[model samples]
Target: MTWLFNNPSEFAKEMISGFVSANASMVRQVSGGVVRNTASKPDTVAIVIGGGSGHYPAFAGLVGQGLAHGAAMGNLFASPSAQQICSVAKTVNQGAGVLLAFGNYAGDVLHFGLARERLISEGIPCELIAITDDISSASADEIHKRRGVAGDLVVFKTAAAAAEQGATLAEVLAVAQMANQRTRTIGVAFSGCTLPGADHPLFNVPQGRMEFGMGIHGEPGIRELAIPTADELAAMLVDKLLAELPAGISRAKGARAGAILNGLGSVKYEELFVVWHGVARRLQEHGITLVDSQVGEFVTSFDMAGLSLTLFWCNQQLEALWFAPAYSPAFKVGSVIKAPLLATEDIEAPAEESVAAATPESQAVAGQIVIMIERLAEAVIKNADELGRIDAIAGDGDHGIGMERGARAARDRAQRAFQQGAGAGTVLQHAADAWADQAGGTSGAIWGVILNTLGTAIGNQEKPTANAIAQAFSQASHGVMHFGKAKPGDKTLVDVLLPFSEELTLQIEQGHDLAAAWQLAARKAELCARATAQLVPKIGRARPLAARSLGSPDAGAVSLSLILNAVGETFPAVHPQGDTLCL
Candidate 1:
């Protein structure tokens, strides 16, 4: 359990503040995260690594010489916003391009990928890579789907070493890719972790049983087994990892590898040593050589009482790079030459975008939008805990908090934009950006796309017609389907969105008013959301443990339905007496 925290929502913010204060000599706080305090060589490729917080020493702790140039820190178990990632990359880019690397998670992929596109458009050469090293997350045939665990250390370290050696962006990317392909990890947990101010852990293992192959974000494992002794557990981890070598070695004999026994939060260092004792013997018995083996906590899950083993198979180049000197607040290798304190890097603010003048009719629409957003925020806040409970079954247990955060952000931004004499479209656009930036996850990105696409369809100068609103819904649906890559029956928000959009268009085509059409479409969405309970998730974090999600609707689907209902309730305000301009 997390014993010390002020406000629950401020936990991530406070953690970043304390971390920066303690390591001021090594790193300094930026708008979204932290960057190295010392300067590096001119034109040296910068390596920016990050993901959700809670995995201490993994992201922020590894930002220094011989490691990452900076980190884009996000909320607890949530990916950093695209704005945050771009900020850190721009701050650290010297002359050479930047390399963005992070663990293989859906939220991380969406946010980082978006940042990469934005950076490229700004004339910054940026390469993105997701470290896929957790063997338990996917089968060998689908290794690209695997998520990174403690193997993050190996991949990040290897890539950073290449950058420190003045390798080009392409070279650093190649080394990082190779390192990820060669590393494999498997983890188990005796207990789950509780978030700050949470009443309970995300999930729990039965007494005398252990969760096998659990993730770092408090996700339950793929399977369960009886607890074993330290030696037996070590053997099990080794056997599983050995069974699936990186497609080259037919056997373990004469293999050289770097091993890490990572303690996930509550596991003591001494206990890890005992497990390492068994790991060493198992490797030796198989005639495999362990080089520069490390035993400590590198990546963690707050207070999850668990551990994992990461084996990095090394060729000559990998061996050399793997053992390279590194210095950070939480990790250090051989001595590294200290560089001079960094001159302040100027982080420029974005230029304000001018809002086009809106008509009185559109301004009335904007006022109604603020009220609708308020209702949406209220719904999300009220149901957050239940949504979180459902997501904890197979996901990282953050959907509720993420929804609440995004909805509230959208409400605030919409109110501000409306007060600034903006139109309906302009207000929605502002709200869309705020939701994505504050939420920082898969849901956040998708919601941003939905709102922004819809906003563009409803132009600022005119009062939107029923036909225009229906077209907007169709475009938003298609945009999300393309952007999120989730189709109907995927057990995602798309399951609700696609149906709702289609039904809304049909009613509008039949000459129904906007309010009437919305009412019918929202009901369709509610039914679709409830029907998702029977589906097996085809993608995202839930795919590995899809069976566990049975009998419960997808959290994303459910939340979308709730928001649609909330929106439906606001139509009377938009169309006075149910007969106002067919709006």
Candidate 2:
């Protein structure tokens, strides 16, 4: 469905380069996303917004005078790495503060949350606000967990406007939160969206049918029904939104709101206008006044033939901000006078880091660690397609590709660390960083936590002992839980990881050799991972379509079990009956 591309792997990057080239007058390329070339007033809060790339104008296209100071773009449908987020923040931050904003997705939450902490630690005075505007993703009772949809524009606009008015960090955050609380969105799809080079779309709908409450990432819709005419569809959308108005609106009658009739992708402007005509009349019939309406592609899935409607319930402050002047590559309001382009300052490249020192014995075992990582790479590559198939059952279907890319990157980094005479722990730490950097998703962040925790446990100064290995496994389990916020039965990799860690720790405490203990633990992981096939997901993008994920093991759980089994096979010969590990 998405045929025009030179290489799928390079698509997201190349797209960013071209976008920057075309908008050079308005934006300047930064390490993570884009920033306005025009200078900001000193001591003004920086509004940095972003998400995955394919949703163009929603992010980078909105970076200009009266919008985001910068955008932290990520890989296609993947959240940007923490390093990338920090780079963009550092570039955009003036003397006042930095505000990080993005949609409420798992990967975005993890990476952006991490970057915020890091910035705060460095005394950058940063804050974060995740937009949760789509009412269909979560119920009113759990409204905090809703996924952000087209209403992202409303929140971004208000927050950026506050910043443009020289509002302090606290003031900017307050207005952004106000906008988020006031917005509601619902989307429907006639069909699914395809990723570049993918043979099929992310999910499919039956002919002559439409799906309701679909997400921007090609996640399956919450419900499906027979297709309706333009007027019928408009009524359905308005009724759904009106039925659940944000608190404080009291009632829809005589209420004023800013409307956004957003085309996901491949939905033409003419079709959007046709839909809007019916939508406008329906709102008027209800005695609701339209403050303003945005009709076109604002947020999108790659070529998805669908649209969403967003209503921002406005008070006097919100209405005035909505009408404020804005100039961006995608959206514009009142007249925006040209400002002198700021002189771009070159950022100094970070100096190469020196590897940590290791004891002679630990260094000798580094080669074995490299071999283990290579086995993981091989296993992931062999099963990548199947992993993707499993993920496609309920998710965006990129898990297999993400896993393969991460494993290979980890293996290569480990090999290089070993060649440099690094210790086992040092090699694993490098591998962990590479895996997280390359993968750039929820799974990638979890894997990075797992390996980094293990590496910390097995310090380079000493050879690893069975008890030390068991402790590292324990730490890894806790680290994954702490970072991923997934419980054992959440149908995530945590299901396999927790059981495996428990079994391994139990066996080692019973005085078993490391290899034999690991073998038993791997078996437990395999069983647990397989058991996930019967579970319904409680988290991530699959939560809404739990039925679709049924009968298919979670992709993360499967990949974890596979890598554990591979590592187990290599351990029997490498670590013998001794308490101390041997290569």
Candidate 3:
């Protein structure tokens, strides 16, 4: 477990500060991650790459002259906020455009997309590319759905090299996209990771067993298998990547490729080198020539004992770019001329946010909403460990942390808005944005959508009636489905939410008051959530790892039901049995 930390919430910030101080000669501190200590070519394209913080060298360590110009580092196992990305992009961008790239995860996609829009609106040109190179996440026919793993290094380097060559923004984008297309990677984990201040690891691998196709964020693998020897493991990885050669590579014979062997965390250099020896021999046996092969940890998952193999099926152009000189904190390709460091002046201040006052009736309602949110926060924090344990069964084990962090943020934001005399809708609106921005995952984004929808339905003029509340919940369900592309029976939170919405509406129609209706609907949601134990996931990170979760209820579904139950308890409703017919 990651035991050494003071005030876990400030871990990422402190890590960034220390990282900048250590590498001040190369990287400078910025709002999000780091930018080059030295200024870049005046009109050159800026390559900004980022993701969560745990992947050390991948993000901040790559910021330098010949590599990434900047990186937007997020909290541990979470994507950076749009505001963070925007700040990094603005600082690094000169007259030329910015190329924003990151791993292909839901939170990264959402935040990067929003940042791109904001930059464009501010008259700064921006481009985006979500690397999708993990062949295990999706089939070849749907490669776009794949996750970006260790192969991200290849794509980032290729793009950064092109930019260093003074390539136009469009040209840089083209080559980056090409690199992504030609790259394929697969990973296997022997165990899972432990975040700072956590007592136990996110997940565990049985002795003498390995989990194949594991994600970098402590997500359980697609399948678990008995451990194999180094050579056998190498062959398994090589054969898989070779099975689907990139287009234009007719066969392994007479083909040249770039190889990257990445140790996830606990896997040592000796272990990787052993695997690489077998990997090289296998390729040579197949008549494939290795070009500029790299063996080390490029991307990591904290202390997870895992390794990934990335094959960059290269042609003439890609091979040439692969050897480009680069200098950074962790990565170095070849020699490069050093440039003078920029002055360590202060960065720009973050934009200010404010809310306007609302009617007194709506303000009173906002106060109540704050109290309810406080209860939600307390409940989530108390049960965070249990939530994480459930999610580790199949999905990434950060659900507990994300939920706890998001609920606390929502509570704080709602309280601030209430103090500012905001209405109930505006209060929830603030909470929604804070949750999504603070928590940075599928759950965070979906919860944001849910609350925002309810905010829109419940206007600022008056207190919401039972009918209004029921309708708001119904609309919120639709919004969640639309935003997340999840449906009922998918073993996601949607399974609980949809039925809860329907029941709430039914209860109100049956003449039960808001207090009674909410409690009844919460019970229904709890039952629906428990029923998900019999279902297999049909989408999201858990889908590929479905078999491992057969007997476990969906973590998100359970959390949603818990939150509903907690909120329902905030109101008094005395109905032990069904009341006599009101009609």
For every candidate in turn, the CA RMSD to the true structure comes to 2.6, 2.2, 4.3
Ranked candidates, highest TM-score first = 2, 1, 3
The Cα local distance difference test for each model comes to 0.88, 0.87, 0.86
Residue-pair clashes per candidate, as listed? Answer: 0, 0, 0
lDDT of 2 by residue, 9-70 (tens): 99999999999899998898877778888867679999999888899787899999888889
TM-score of 3: 0.86
What lDDT score goes with residue 2 in model 2? 77
Candidate 3 residues 241-276, lDDT tens each?
999988887898988888999999999999999999
Candidate 1 lDDT over residue span 281-303, tens digit each: 99999999888799999999999
Which residue pairs collide, candidate 1? none
TM accuracy, model 2:
0.94
The stretch of ten residues in a row with the least summed lDDT in candidate 3 is 574-583
**Best-fitting candidate, measured by TM-score?**
2
In model 1, the runs with Cα more than 4 Å from the true position are 345-364, 392-397, 459-463, 572-579
Against the true structure, what is each candidate's TM-score?
A: 0.93, 0.94, 0.86
